[model samples]
Target: MPDFPFDAETHRRRRERFLQETGGGVAIFCALPELVKSRDTEIRYRPDSDLFYLTGFTEPGTVAVLTPHDEEHGFTLFVRPRNPEREVWDGPRAGPEGARERFGATAAYPIAELDERLKGLLEPADAIFYTLGSDAAMDRRVTELLRGFRLTRPRSGKGPADVRDPSIILDRMRTIKEPGELDQIRASAAIAARAHAAAMRMARPGIGEWELEARVESTFRASGPTAGTAFPTIVGSGTNATVLHYVDNARRTEDGDLVLIDAGAALGLYCSDITRTFPVSGRFTPAQREVYEVVLAAEEAAIAAIKPGAPFTDIHEAARRVLVQGMIDFGLVTGTVDEVIEAKAHQRFFMHQTSHFLGLDVHDVGAYATADGSPVPLEPGMVLTVEPGLYIPAADDVPERFRGIGIRIEDDIIVTPDGHEVITRAVPVNPDEVEALVGTEQAHTETQRHGGEG
Candidate 1:
């Protein structure tokens, strides 16, 4: 695994901020548990993004409690203790002692002590903030603690009264990216660009979609031994691209087809999402080029609107305008652009929106409002994806010549004070650039060795 992207000090500050936001609550957060594949086999462990964001610790089954008493000091972390036998079979664990020393936990205890220690931590608190019902086992434990608290008598003037979820406090914090977080996301985006570039280079008329998947995955590995693609790659060719989240990758590429690849790479939980549509034969036919150009224009228009203080909804609408007009100009639909926009006639060929928040989760949580509870104003440190697409399925929709074609262009972007930074700019968006990039060059030299080129 790559070195930890977050610092211990950052994790400490995050917890402190949450505590301050919650006033005086005992907030409980548990690292997600590893699931069993069978009797003993376990699926690969991936720590929850929120847990990792606050703790910088990736071990599963670890839990933490930020309490009032520790507000003056620090939070306490409860972790699984290390076992020599288990370590030999699996790997080293950051046990209780390591958690305290390395993770800056004020107090560290074995996870086995949670039931006993939790009551003590919650006794004098005002509220208990937790993620409700996320883990049934953890939920039961919290219920038991709350039940016991309810049964216990209140001191004359001192006893806990409420249980609330602290996620409301944390989600707002996560929406804005920090300088370090941007660096991690940029790294992830760079890796994602390489993967997309690899797939484009290896594409050919006879290649199976799985071959493109291999190219994408291999590019991620080659870029750096980081977390794999942030999500399963959509390596759809021709009509499959219209399916949106296409992942089967079973179809074979053919002449005069477009391959829509929606993929990204994850590094230290930070993600970079990108999409590009290219011709299987390395050159877009006239009909494909016409539609691809419109989507590209929409992508650029959306990207241009992503400035600090701008409403993201504006960008979405901006992209939609270009696509709606294109459908009219191409005679794909018969109506005024304004009428089509109102009727959402573009939904036939362009169904999805233009962008979404991007970060720790592909769609990271952040406030999209101001202090008065309106839509969150965009600000520096926010990252998002600008993807604009046009999908024309082989349907009896007015024209047979403009059927079964799909094209989309996406890039990871960070809002800047004056403008927005295209983080995934390394992946070209111009149709001419895309053709030139995928047409023939070093890509062919590399993929030809792998027998990916026809």
Candidate 2:
């Protein structure tokens, strides 16, 4: 058997914490079901983030049940049974016996027995903790089980009365990363940094956008660590850069155009998201440089404000202030910085929030606001992304020099005791540094070609 990234004890501690947080309840988690892509094909299987966080098992059709405060058995797992025929088509399964032996489950059973056995488990629970509206099939099954239990409650005096979403407790626990989780995230950042660097080196005026995407993705996969992309790679160039979340990487790069590549890699299920915009010709034009500098300054301001106990909104405010002031200075807006911000005038260029919780999911779990709907304070072990961008459309209202120029600078940051650390700092974001890096690579490629001819 392959060595898992996390040990069994780590999962045990997580389950214990979940139980304590929920007091005494039966918490159920279902793994992601396989989705069909075509008549006989299926999309690649990726485990659900929440399920994988609590239990490291990645196979489909697996379900985990946690009975807190139960003396006999606190953890039970239902897994696919081992079969030679199925193993021939698909890969091998952990099976019920392997689940008990490898995953530290107190009891294990074949998944075929879930419907029959789950009812008995639900009959004695006072409260149920499950993720609702996730899997429709699983949702129906759970509802039917609860309905049966409720119908029999007249005589047995059992079954849960309260149903709560497990994310309430699970999200909080996941917000604070453990040392192991940090290590995984840091490794992911390192791989993504290298991939971005590769993309920068390969970018040229005549290259197709998909070529750069291929280079970055190949580097990510070749570097190991399960070799998966955190999300679809974004390699937008020129006018395409203005569209946020643009994944159609089919455009060709042109001279004097800026390319924005927002891509990341996953290592041990942790993700690293990064975005860097650089000139396709290896040096930024005067117009591109001006906008790039503003976005970089905004990103820096946001990152500098990240500290323990600081309100989460502080980061966004710092970035917004810088961006609004830049817009005023560039004559993009008429009002003063404060006036523009108050009047919501900056949304024309700088739109999205400066930061988001980053972890297993690119936009990871965790509530941004408190009970009263105020921004939550930062805490140690929390990881986030500091991304600030400026996008100018080619319109009559926009200044001709800055029009059609979109630039964004982003980095992955981790909150620490005294300050914060940028894990994705390997790639150059400074204008001069980026120019030199790309120029050096371009020169090297030309020299190699001449040398080969000689």
Candidate 3:
């Protein structure tokens, strides 16, 4: 079986692009190390996004070397040798043989030979493209190799003269999604949309946050055509929603609380991120709907602003303007929209940026700005997320009804020739649809209790 679903040609194209950007530089990629959760239990292993993106090989104990100009070994793999004994316990491996034949490596060797083999690959290169700080052992090996090469420079007189971060080349490539990558992300978005709808239908007072998390994740697992979550599933309710990055999911939702779910699924390593906030009581209170409307408007406006040639920050600015005005209208801050935005006074309620590059990683790989420090222009094939949120703490200064409320609406978007497509609309983002969907299970249970007579 192939380690990844993508055909070797798909990866070849990406690598070709990377090499073109690097101008035939030597590059090194080390797969992530498997981690131990505790004594003998191992955490589920995932490949580094960059390595997986370039090579479509998702194995640990592997390193890939790219010498772009060397036709014979332009792309080399150093990987774990297949062992029957270990396979019985830890599952199958794509061994070095598979590396070349299955994954399209020009040359392959056992990982044990990397130190001996890598020296030759780096000797004639003028520049090296490698990111440090991923693996300590790999960092040391590369540093020592560079030192040794420096010592031998008088004799050989040829070695890598500069080391550049691969992200400089990779970020640009990843930001613009290829057709295949966009397909994967679209599939991922569909799964996440279904999962969100499932969770929303089941939401009701007295439900545990963890239950919502499980419902959404179970939907991802059962409906996959997916690898797993893009990141940890968040099911924050009430005040917890105000605390960004809250993944505890231990609290029991009370009536009228708003549940903020920020979840995404990984489909063939590409990802979809979506966030939807809905009321727990089956219907949103006037205040909850009012707050949610602001966020929805902001999210919609931001997504609408995504078009070819528009700077990426245009989306942020559009969303920020809406949020700032919403804050002003709500009296959360006392100023005009422009005044509030200029002072960043509304950031207290909406602390995060409105959009981010979305694809392989949740945040994905992309530079927000050009080398000149200006925002990058949006182009066809770019995928991103438009999420706008407001969090009002239960503070004495806040209006009583607005306090303890948090709302965020997010959708995955793809930039197209004319404009953008919002892929995550499979699930409802409109407040009416959200209200109609939330607590459907509870309502159905009630109808059953009454013998189908409402």
Candidate 4:
């Protein structure tokens, strides 16, 4: 699909880097299995992120074997054999021949031959790098293979003595954005930004939350044939917004209600995640504006602290300080900002963290802290989301006007050498700008009523 974005050389380079980290070991990667949705129907299949990162192969029943020091045959692929009858039901397969010719594999074999081939590959390797416990079937198969290898160790004098998880190297590599990955992430962010803008304009009283969900997904699909949402869209209106992970979009918007939309798009395997809240009536109430401004201030402060060399915790601290102070100023809580933060009293309204790693997966792989339990420094190639939210439920402790209000502003930012870049700036976040865009719905409706006479 879409020519796989990168060539086989790029994948080979990544594999080489991984090999360097893994040292003299044989690494094995298996693609995820297809799942049955019902009695016979199957859901759309997506390749495992780890396997795809190394081979650029998106087919199921495929396994890749890497031998770092092998001069003639370092990379080997085992894929499902091509069958004419199965080809009619499913799509065409790369087959063993195509795998060697197109994927640059040193050698290729049918899936049925994997067990037999593993004997030769693992005989000389002292260590094995694999994702243990990920697949029970594969785990059993590998265990049996190792046991078989041990039985022959007296005759061959070699077998793996250690096993390691490949994620130790792969996760760290994925944290830093490469040039090709940045292009895909930027494209996905741009499409998601446009979808958010369209949803903002279409939001109005009496509109069902599912309608906005439909509009967002349709906009993403319209952007490109390969584009689709990275996650299930979150379109919560009114009180439903208070629920953190609300997906039941069954409520209808009401006057003076705030709709919080958390959505993103997946383009070329890279993902973008963004969240924006706006007034359903195109005008924020006084109480809504008060809370919205606080969350906005927190987001801005967090984004400002995202420069390279800054501690990752610094960003969250900057946002938390502003939110805690704002809560005190609004009379929602009664304590100094320091006391409130120390006691975590502000968590009553704001609970989640201010940021997260964003990439191929929405909550992408990356270590936030070092082995010593200290915050890691932000690097130039790291990309993250800065999101600050305040959700106030209906309780006696909360003020009447501020109850049932939820507002969160999120954006994707890339750490630059000197500063940070906001990749999703295509969508407006200022309160006035949000109102201006949302007001266009009424203007369009007016024009349609008069049959374009205006």
Candidate 5:
């Protein structure tokens, strides 16, 4: 939307790299279909990340056919034909003509012609790359096309015989951030950081979780019309924070509550994921501070372990050890840290993994391990999220003061040659800074907005 952060040539280079990696296989990628939100209303459509990565076309009912190194007609597009009738109702489409003129398609045709055109395209290919089973209707159409191709094989004698997922190459390519991709990721992180800070300052007892959600996302949109959310903003408060994916921001936060916000922004199609917990009363209770400090230490340790050549597991291991020790120190568990870790006693308080690859998709795809299930070594340009959390439920087994508390600290990290750089540090993670930040700036901000009256 914001004139994609990269130029057409950049997109072409990516396609070229993809072609080189796939070893000249014929590949087809479809844009994701629009979904019905209600009986008649449709949800906002986002292009399939894979298709958008290669073609930069963001329209439904569109397919890209790529033949490595063929040049003259190597990149072909089949798109929905423009219709004045549909145009007046839905927006204008980039018809086949526009596809060729603007999108660098060597050949373009109506999507209705895909079934007829695909045969010719595949006749010369030995191996075809396409993801199956993603869209049911599309899957049926593709299988039917394959059946037709198989039946017609005698006539062509060179039809595609092997099929594989294009992600075989695409995923590995996406693992390392290109300079432009990192720029977009950093920009998104910057915007999200500001949004988090705004949420922190606006936090106060009696605030609605939905209001904070709005404030964070509005900060994203306020950055630019095209800048937006990476995922639904999560604003879980008090005991709700214990629920890992709690998103129903329907409750009002009471004093002494800790509101956890896990949110991000999508700018130029790249994403940023960040989470921070704040005290509704602007200062954590002693019990809350004790658990918060433990989680913070784990987060800092995990992030410190992110550097080039470190196994991805090191990040989790570093965080996990501290949390296990904390459970022992706080008397939530009885055994030694190693003993508890071996028994997985820490799972009661910390259940999720410490980090995940973060990129175009929030839980972005890139193999975390090699074929034999060994941790992938971190390389420069690889981006990930380092998050450490502790959720203690109000149960008889838990210490009364520490119960019903949850704290998670997260930051986006970029692996550099020397070490890692945290892009989301714009929002303070230090306990003292966090306490000092909460609910302190809102009054000053309001006063300044109303002509700076003393």
Candidate 6:
């Protein structure tokens, strides 16, 4: 019910661009397949993000073909057929008839006829563009079809053509998002920001970390059914926060500890990723404040370098400098910033890059390769997350005051022609602003009404 109608115009334009790049080859893309949870049970189904981005069609068992080579036949779509009996349990699908008219496909066919139909479409084309080896079932089907086509003899016998990577052409187009996509991503980031704020306000001693995850998810769901979390929520407290990919969220919050919340909300298929570390008691202790400020400074520095024409690696290096300097200041290391970075000493507390591209997936895809197939450059319309973290595990080498203190500050940002735009501003990151947002009487009222926090 929360799904929006498929935008025909968008699909048409996307096909046009892909066709132009392929120069008359056939491109094959499949919808994400459903997964099973247990015996006779299935997990919630979400369509593949790439397929959804182009067609806005989230239904299963769909395949799209863009042909730039064969002028006579192009833009073919394959979909499921209507079956009332199955519709009673699942749902009615847009059959071939509806797909051709609604999606601007040159022709449409039932998925059942994929093998029979694909053979003819594959011929006359110079090359086949596909994500080969990605889906073993689809791959096997395609291979079998190709093998059969090769054996069959037409009145004028000919063999099948070659296969190529469609990513080479499509990745270039998907890298720069359109205006509509940017708008959706911005809205998603705002929702995620509010969700992070809600989690901070609800965090408290005596409550399990999972309670904070619930609060974060509840804020997203309250917005709309489509506004559920984009990924698994990470609500880690104390030493657990030191684990970068922590997602269990089962530990209990305790007095004098900081909670690290990494979460996001999905709005209209667009996603936003955000992480904020705040005090569980609504105020940071001296040690917690010290580490949080350092991470915040590095995050700000990383974001400041997000301008057009700047290298994506530049931002990472900038944040690295800040973290290295902080490490020296805290007496965790004994060297200058350059010396520490060269020696790779910063890996002790900071282990990952400052940011990565964020869009449909948390780590969106594109031609990360340079023009010569090396590292790519930053450009406008690219959205990325600037997250800088400092994690100090409990160890003898670490200063006693710095032990078990971990902090990460993250925000979603968009590159502009001149500079960048911070999309997740709704979530306060400042020490004072975060304290104020979580310390209000309204927050306490909600916590009390929830029957002892969770």
Off by over 4 Å in 5: 148-156, 445-454
Residue 169 error for model 6, in Å?
1.9
Alpha-carbon runs more than 4 Å astray in model 3: 1-3, 445-454
Task: Give lDDT tens digits, candidate 3, residues 397-447.
Answer: 988889989888899999999999989999998899888999898888888
Clashing pairs in 4: none
Clash pairs for candidate 3:
none
Worst 10 residues of 3 by lDDT: 1-10
Candidate 1 local Cα displacement, residue 15, angstroms: 1.5
Worst 10 residues of 5 by lDDT: 1-10
Which residue pairs clash within candidate 1? Answer: 175-366, 368-375, 368-376, 369-375, 369-376
- Give candidate 6's error at residue 154 in angstroms: 13
User: What are the TM-scores, per candidate, against the unseen true structure?
Assistant: 0.93, 0.97, 0.96, 0.97, 0.96, 0.93
* Local distance difference test, each candidate: 0.82, 0.88, 0.89, 0.89, 0.88, 0.81
Candidate 6 lDDT for residue 332: 94
Screening candidate 5 with a backbone cut-off below 3 angstroms (N, C-alpha, C), the clashing residue pairs are none
lDDT tens per residue, model 6, 215-257? 8888888887677788899988999899998999999988888
Q: In terms of TM-score, which candidate is strongest?
A: 2
lDDT of 5 by residue, 6-50 (tens): 666777888888888677578888888899999999987878998
Error of 4 at 227 (Å): 1.0
Clashes of each: 5, 0, 0, 0, 0, 4
Tens digits of per-residue lDDT, candidate 1, 9-88, equal 99988877777888767788888879999999998777887788788888887887888566533588888899999889
For model 5, state the Cα shift of residue 2 in Å: 4.9
Colliding pairs, model 2: none
Model 4 misplaced stretches (Cα beyond 4 Å)? 148-155, 451-454
